[model samples]
Target: MTQTKRRWRVSPATIAPVLIISWAVTSAIATGFNFRPLVLLELQTQALFFRLRGEVAPPPELVILAIDDDSLTRGRDAKELKELASIRSWPWRRTAYAEAIDKIMAAGARSVAVDVLWDLPSERPADDQRLQQTLKRYAGRVTLAAIHATSESIGGGLDQLVYPDPMFQVDPKAIGLINYSPEPDGQLRRFASVYLNQIDADLRQSKSDLLSFDEASLQTSKLPFNAPKGDYIFFYGGSNTFAIVPFWTVLYPQNWERLKQEQIFKDKIVLIGPTAAFLQDIHPTPFGDLSGIEVHANAIATLLEDRAIAEVMPDPAWRGFYLFLALAGIGLAIGQVSKRTTPRFVLAIVIAGGWWLVGYASFVYGGLILPVAAPFLAISLSGLFYLSTGAANDQLEKLRLRRTLERYVAKPIVKEILSQPEDFQALLQGRKLNAAVLFCDIRGFTTLSYKLPPETLVSLLNTYLNAMVEAVAAASGTIDKFIGDAVMAEFGSPVSYGEETDAMNAIRAALGMRQALAALRSQWQQEGKTLLYHGIGISYGEVIAGNIGSLRRLEYTVIGDTVNVASRVEGLTKSFWTDILITDALYQRVQEHVEVVFVGEHLLRGREDSPSRLYSLIGLKGEAPTLYHQVHEELRRYLGYIEATES
Candidate 1:
């Protein structure tokens, strides 16, 4: 039993599409993992977008009364304040905050939310009583911090609130929880309106009606905030985005009248909190570190204005759109390879850049955050995949075309064409090129074939054709075709090496064929086989050369008067009784490099008025005639001569 061989076919153009599809599938799967690399990249893009846009305007009604370094130092140096000042230390006397609250309320502040905690009783009973009196006097207008369980633990348990202070228990409605939950990366991107169960219990236990201070401010303003599931991704500006005034400036007697004149606290939600560096109330935001007080102001402003940051829809359909974009980019690049390749690459880059810009613009102008990294990575990888594989395909095509051409033309000519594909394409477009045509035919082949068996005659013919074909190839000549017992070839075409070189190559090929045939005849005679002879003709002139035929079947060849004349000249070689002959055109072109004797100007069958001058080729200018030429000259007068003549 015999097994049949199977052939596998591969197309060079198929590689680009395969790579594109693979990249799209792989990237889509990676994106589904919420891949950590793209997540980090998204964070960077978010930060950069905020930094480039700088600060956005905050709500005008929101202001922070900062308990800053000046308020803590009271215009004294750290050493002096520590050693000499009675009320200059941090966590200043509760009476000081009570006086500050009294001043802000008198100045017509809409609401006062103290970021400071009042979860513990003061060491001075008089100070606690004084702060409690102010809280009771403006119970509904003021709000104080209600420390939650977690925040209480963070503050060293000094202000941990099992309940509100006993002094303000009469006016517990003035308290709200001051707890913030930052993101996992320690950047504050959003805020919560209400606390969890633990803080909710603390609020109820302290008897505070508001969930948080920001919620209290929102409730007091009677503005509606439509957040999704009670969660808000609020817009953030840089540090100190809100109008902040030092706490001491409002509390000092001389500055109290100045604040009233400036209307700084009039109808504004004044949030009083520590802004000093030593207080460590700063939290990292996308723009920079911001004080917890300003974060609250931002939260209140977001609630009052109802401007929350929207997110890109996290749906499979949305993710698939980005994957489709990557596939489209690769398809576009591959499609353009047959035409304008440079514009294709430029457009790929522009599309990738535009994709990122769209994400950033959505965040900046539309208050929405769109997914950026996964899509960008997919597009970039697709582009690289197409470009790299596309290059490999081009190289494979060059190699394939070269192999096919080597069968019709010489190896050297194919190499030259492969090196410059552009020039080869131009030549195939049908152009007039200077070339030399040579025609060789076996002598008396019709009668000789009848004397031998069909198989023997065919084998002899194939041997002769092989010898002639090799001779043409060795001389850098293109084998145009084989007609019966004849061979037609061309030199200096598809590519030109000038008329002079073409003439020399054709002449050299004819001489080589003469020697090769002589060797074949000797071998055949030694083997007791009938010997064969052939005649050659060469002509040099302009010819129309290119791929000519119907679109479905084309052939690269030449057709002109020069081709006809070369065939007619080969007939004359038999008439002159010589193995080699050349027209006057080819002879004159190569006269400087080759030695030839004039055969005569003869009027052959077709045209009598136009007669062609022909010559017989000898050896090169400096070569000696060997046994073949010597025997040929003696055997026939057309073979060799010492001098050249004009007919």
Candidate 2:
């Protein structure tokens, strides 16, 4: 059996459109407008891409002076600190940070951002005065830290700003909202350049009156903030990526010479904050968990260069467009693929990989955040759905073909044609091929029909036809059609097993039909019912085989001289007094397999000039001496006499 050719069928245009819209809608719902789980995932993916691409060098102009473990431990361990420190705790006094600020500014730093908050006054008035005087000395060049108003501060009346005490008199320009709000997953992925205007409202001043230290420094540097308001993803490298200095190094007089020699803080933006592990200001970020001061430094670095990750899709509409394109392109490609597993599977993988590449390229080269996971999911799911439906349609088509073919052929033959339908379709369309055509007819059917009642006659005819069909099927013969009580069958046409096998199968089927009729006759005689008998004639030659009749109803059968000769020979069986007859062509092919008697040459209906020799079939070589034993024996003697005379 030849393999069936695969036919690729695309689903209707509406299928892709509907599925695209559904995917887009689903994506929109899952990643809510500001509730950004998908956005968070995209940000994480971008971080991975950047990490694999390698770290970008940070700006040298930004410096972090962390009051780290050494500063805290040394300050606490010092004998003089143990006596002089009234609190004897980590946060010594405002005076210590005040001295550090003076030293850093004296080192020629461009600006000083104090990440520590002074929301309350110091216990000693002298310490507060010292910090106050230091801020007054730098004024516009120094910025102080302010805690962003949290949910608990809702009753603070709109300003949503926490500032130092009035006695300290810190410059408002020095106050930066140190709120590095993280995503809901507790990851610090973005930086808020400006908090809500509620702070302006609470201050009893216009919105213009309130500005975070970040905004003030950008203004001081004469640089514009290019990112949108609210929040933007700030690029962060690993922890401790920035140049850091211990707070005590700048404050303690002993280390002054080394700091001056290094000049690391020369003309740099200095951020002062705590970096001790005991100070739980750490937050999770993409690179890793970092101290709050490092988060601020990363924000400052991003602001200095204006290198915030630009969102390729700032609106839901843009994301919808991406989803549409993904589904349309991949869905159409999947639709065109044949209903074969390997091709569809390969196509699915390619679509997924292509979408991922597009997203990654957009982010790496353009600094754009493109949604990858959702679009990839949409494309893969659409392809899988199409492949599943295509498979179902293929199975349905095979079943339909099976139902049609089984009516005219055996179950196994039907199965073969369905499995490999390529040649079977060609056979249905007209083709000329060599085949053995067997025609069987009941003897005296007209008289037999009248003698019995209508019901009895129909029942008897149906029983006879059923037996004939079974015999033909048992030999793998294709039933051409039934005419009244006559059955026509063909072999080696629609499906071939070689000419010799077809000839032998046809002869065997004819013999089975004769034996079945004989058995029925015996049973009917014992039960006192009408007897039945059938005559068969087979011919082998080229004939036109295909569907015949009107468009609405067709009969699959063979035509041409071969079929005509078979029918004519079946008609002569009564005259010759034989149960089965075959033309010389069929007899020659099966001569080696069975015994036969020559019945002399006779002119068939259409071929009157070229008379074809006919023969009566005897049982298999030594099987039995049945109804044709006398004829078989006489033919052997006659052939021997003729040979002797010729010799």
Candidate 3:
């Protein structure tokens, strides 16, 4: 027997490590290299967390004094409201803001942060002095907005710091930078308490470290605020989450009684900034676009409520910890499970959903933000890897089975069995089918074995069996088994073309074996080796065909009177001096396609009363005349022996 070639197999032990390593490398690229797309994806997933959480109530202590279109346009045409009419257009007179501050302070507000920048003094000196005096009155309780301009030089460092006019800077702690730093994707999610700059003293003296407007307001309000140096702002909701009062409402005399009655600003931190569309103060947020004033309000509220979301550390060790958790999750999901695609896929989906739930719960209940995108991707990629490899493995397994089956069965039969596995499996369990069984054995094998050495005998037997197997295989017959020098084959088993086709193929295979034996005889005469001859007997009937034997060793073969009768018929070939014989059942099916002579009914060895009718197979009906003549002459040489046996 030829050795089968070794094939490469993908085992779980190999697949598991490869999956883990692939995940690790991908995570490293996402974290260590700061893969921009993945980072953006992570941001989007975090936004989903916010949506899942829905709207939350903001702190009542935070208020947004919006300088809206109503505040800017309502009093424009009101002739009785002369002060408001005079300040309808932007760059309103400083006295208008001064009056609003006095009213809010009198209303018992804790602190006020103005988000409007005041880098240059107004054209009217009296108006500037009026606002300056009001700011000095509540210096420690008020905060003014400033801005940092990036230099046009290389690296885009902070070039200059623009503060409120000198007259309006009543207290050093009153000035704070109102710069909003949005993420690369243009969403403002984080807040910085202080912004440090490197610049000369001449441009701005002793002001290298600037506080954010929200932080400055907290300090001025005397609130005990301690937070991370830099962190994410857990937004309460979208626009208008904080209570908003139009800027003009606080300054309008007609609303004064209502404001004082409502006490809307009582001990509250008020952020005053432009909120009108033309003001260009709209900024993107997790929930949606929010006015700058509302953004600051949310920031201050986050600090007051200690609702800052802390991110998992980004160090290698911390990232590895997260990766480990992801691998562990995937392993638990699919490890040691069946190699079925559906089950593995379902488990993977469950694992991903569970991880998302964990992340959302962490954010909602613990004020922590876990990495969602990278780990989720890891699970998905691993699932796809396993599914793809699993499919490949299935194909490989089928190939292995086909190769093994081909060793004993014909290639065509093996292919048919594999192609329709369900039907073949049913056949293996057992089935009754009309089929043709062929049994062929060497004539006088015992005498031949005695005359030759063991090696020569074995070689000659192998050559003869090889020729017999090829003939059967050519006729689409499965080589059932080989008993030493004999070959057993079956047609129309496991699969069938038709009854007539199977009978014709069996007769064709027997004739082919005779021709093969004649060629071997010529070859042996030239090689000075012993000649060999084979006798074939074919029977057609309903037989139980199936894989029969112990669990460890099973054989696909037929077991019935048909098989036994076929063997007994082959034993009579030598007695009758014939090469091929067939029972009447098979001859009736193939009689139109073959030429045969009826060999009168005779009781087989086991059947004492009932005898089987048989025929001597000569040649096919459509063969050349010369071929038929040659076969006729061959049978004529045995005529005398057959007549003498009858006598």
Clash counts for the predictions, in order: 0, 6, 0
Best-matching candidate per TM-score:
2
Give the higher-TM-score candidate: 1 or 2.
2
Residue 87 local lDDT, model 2: 24
Over 4 Å off in model 1, which ranges?
A: 1-13, 57-60, 73-92, 117-184, 193-237, 255-261, 299-307, 320-345, 398-415, 421-476, 479-488, 497-532, 535-647
Which is the leading candidate under lDDT? 3
- The lDDT values for all models are 0.73, 0.73, 0.78
Order of candidate numbers by lDDT, starting with the best: 3, 1, 2
Summarize candidate 1's per-residue lDDT along 1-647 as a digit string, tens digits: 99977655565346556666666666665555656665567677778888888877887887888888777777355344332232466567888788888888888888788888776887888989898888888877776666656344554643344446667755436556666666545677666443433344554565544466677656554446655322444555887778989877765557778889999988888898988888998988787888878878887887777766666666645575566565556555545654333344455566667878998888777777777666666566555655565555556656766765687778878888888736334556688988999999877677677788999999999999999999998888988888999999999887778888878889889889988988887899899997787788888888998878885567778989899888988888766677788989898888888777788898755657799899988868887767447536533542222112111
**Considering TM-score, which of the candidate structures 1 and 3 is the better prediction for this target?**
1
TM values, all candidates: 0.69, 0.73, 0.67
lDDT of 3 by residue, 1-647 (tens): 99977667676535754775678567855665667887798889888889889889998888888889888787565657775864666778788788888889889999888988878988888988888888989988989988777667566665678888887887655777777667767898887452322334565555745677878889899988886533788889998778999888877777877988999989988888889987898999999998888888888888888888887664745665667665655654574574465567667767777878888898777788777777777776666666766666556656765665686667877877778735234556688999999999876677668778999999999888888888888888878899988888888986788999998989888988888878887899899998776678999999898889985678778889889999999887766667788999998898888877788998998887898999988788867545434544554454444356556
Task: Report how far residue 32 has shifted in candidate 1, in Å.
Answer: 3.4
lDDT of 2 at 390: 46
Model 2: per-residue lDDT, tens digit, 136-181?
8887777776666645454664424677676654554545667755
The local distance difference test score of model 2 is 0.73
Clashes of 3: 0
| Predictions: Cα RMSD each | 7.7, 8.4, 8.6
